[model samples]
Target: AVTALRLISPSTALRNLGAATGIAGFIVASLILIFYAIVAGWMIAFCLSSVANLLGMSDFAAWLTSFGLWRNILFMLIFITFTIGIISAGVKDGIERWSARLMPALLITLFLLVAYVLTLDGASEGLKVFLLPDFERALSPKLIIAALGAAFFSLSLGVGTMLIYGSYISDDENLPVVGGLVTLVDISIAVLAGFLVLPAMYVALHNGVEIFTPTGALISEDTLIFTVLPELFATMGTAGIVVSFTFFFLMGIAALTSSISMLEVPVAYVIEEHGLKRKTAVSAIGGIIAVASSTILLNFENLFGLVVAFTTRYSQPVLGFMFCIYAGWVWHRDTLLQELRKGNPDVEQGLFWKIWPWYVKLVCPVIILGIFAQSLWG
Candidate 1:
């Protein structure tokens, strides 16, 4: 199967451009993993801490949740190591199997947590705020741009991760249908998450935890996961410990799933392009990312937010724009049509066949560039 790097065009120069795009994507993915691992480590730490709480080791649990440099580094290494171990085992045995098991578990846990949180006092207010959008604020260009970024990043659109994953799909699968289902699932999970988080925030406030500032902004908006939710759990007594454990465990699974894709982008590149063994690629790439993660941890005050903004805010949309260009303009139209026909011979008569070619070719590139320009200068 052709890798993402080779998917752009048959022409030599355009193929090199595709390779450069892939490399840029690899770099951005690495940068994202640097900080992403740190937060993922927090999820692991919180999971263990909840277990400690369950065992009545309150002090140990507190220390585990504390933002200690050593604790952060330890859990970060552990998370990266787990990622390496999984990818090293190869895709069918490692990625597919674990993802098959964990994703369902993650969803089940999310549903249960949402149900429980909604039953708490003040949760109705949160539900109202979440479901009832304020049109005035929603129309803000800034909010719309941010929303676009969130959607793209959440779906891993700009990254070669999805492109690489697509290469694994059998030719018999309908690409549009598969892509739609994936999008639906992703959006459902995100919405379900809001059902849990927003109501839980209000519940925390009801339990006397500080959730809002004087200006009505959320307190510790950036650190809400590590702060408000834990305090909210503490208010629930024994049940809180169980809930906290379940919640953090859910978070850990989510982190692991996402990190696997990010790491796979580069690992796939090295394995396919450099002729390296999967294990060697996983270890070398994972180790280098781990070192970069350590660097961020060491200089947390300075580099953390900078890297986050650079990768997610700036780099992602730009890469996504490039993907739109390659897909819509560079890739031959007949080839794309032929590829679509592999799964459905009558696809040419379908609505997607009629709309998508032009939509992706013209509409997608324009929308992506508009988003990029807004984010850049807005």
Candidate 2:
């Protein structure tokens, strides 16, 4: 009966589904945070650590001890300048061009290391532990939630990032195909990152050193990739030096790409909403982010938690909900389907029109809101 209703009134069903999703509130919050602050903190942290290490710091902890607050402030300025310069150029000219050049090199380096790991003596054991899910092991509700969040977050979905990128896409581009490809690429990178990190960890364990567990660190997964992976690479002998260079080099690129998207959000907002020129808008936004980042670096404390908590609990989920609403509801289903069908003229409108409404309206929004509430309360 429900299937008949969906088939009979596909467009209306989709609209009703989108309305039921309840994503309108959270999506607005995400847009604001993305345009303003979340990505800036991550960029600030990346630049300070990357630049300092490139200059041969003994350790990040020791570098912090020696460099003090002003050095990080300086780092923030450099980071903002670098970010704004690239973002102001627009995505095709800036992001796509640089990514085209850099990503291939990064991938080749990572592949070599993965090949080496596969050939390692105890690699089979490490691979099994990572790839095979063991049901017997106690599954914490928290870890399951985290994994799901990571899956969505890491894909760069639920935010307007994909939508903004989509806007730049040519009419010839296949929407569904391109979206699926991007999702696959992002997931592959995350899994490859795990492969690169985990085998080296077990190698350390075998050699009688303490292995770091996910629960052992206060830092996020990205930080662990940046900071700790260098030490892991050091375990490999003469090849270690090359691996270290590749690891940090690849990491720097990943950090920069994500940061560029973040900076573009505000720069594009100003350009669209206000009549400001691109260069001028970039400068203003960059300066604000640099100042805010410097403040965070100088006084890392409870405020960090507060900012992060607010963004995660309210901002991210809201933005995600908003994106679905915008794409699913606000944008006419016929219009969206028309766009989707543009490059792929032979594509059928059967299930897409039916499932899409529920997905955008009722399903995704509720799941995201629930995740946010759970994060905040639990």
Q: What is the TM-score of each candidate against the true structure?
A: 0.96, 0.76
Best by TM-score: 1
Number of colliding residue pairs in each model: 0, 11
lDDT of prediction 2: 0.59
| 1-378: candidate 2 lDDT, tens digit per residue | 112112323487564544333233223323333333433334345434545555666487345424356655655465566667777776778878866876787678778778876776666667877889877553766565556565655655554455456667899887777877987888788788778667765664555445556677423444454445445545665465555555556655665666666666556656665779888987887776666665666565645566656655555665576565555555656766676677777555556555667787888777777667667775
Best by lDDT: 1
Each prediction's whole-model lDDT (CA): 0.89, 0.59
Q: Give the per-residue Cα lDDT of candidate 2 at 356.
A: 65
Candidate 1: lDDT of 227? 93
Q: Estimate, for each residue in 147-237, the C-alpha lDDT of model 1 and write its tens digit.
A: 8888988988887888888888899999999999999999999999999999999999889999999999989999899999999999999
The residue pairs in collision within model 1 are: none
TM-score of 1: 0.96
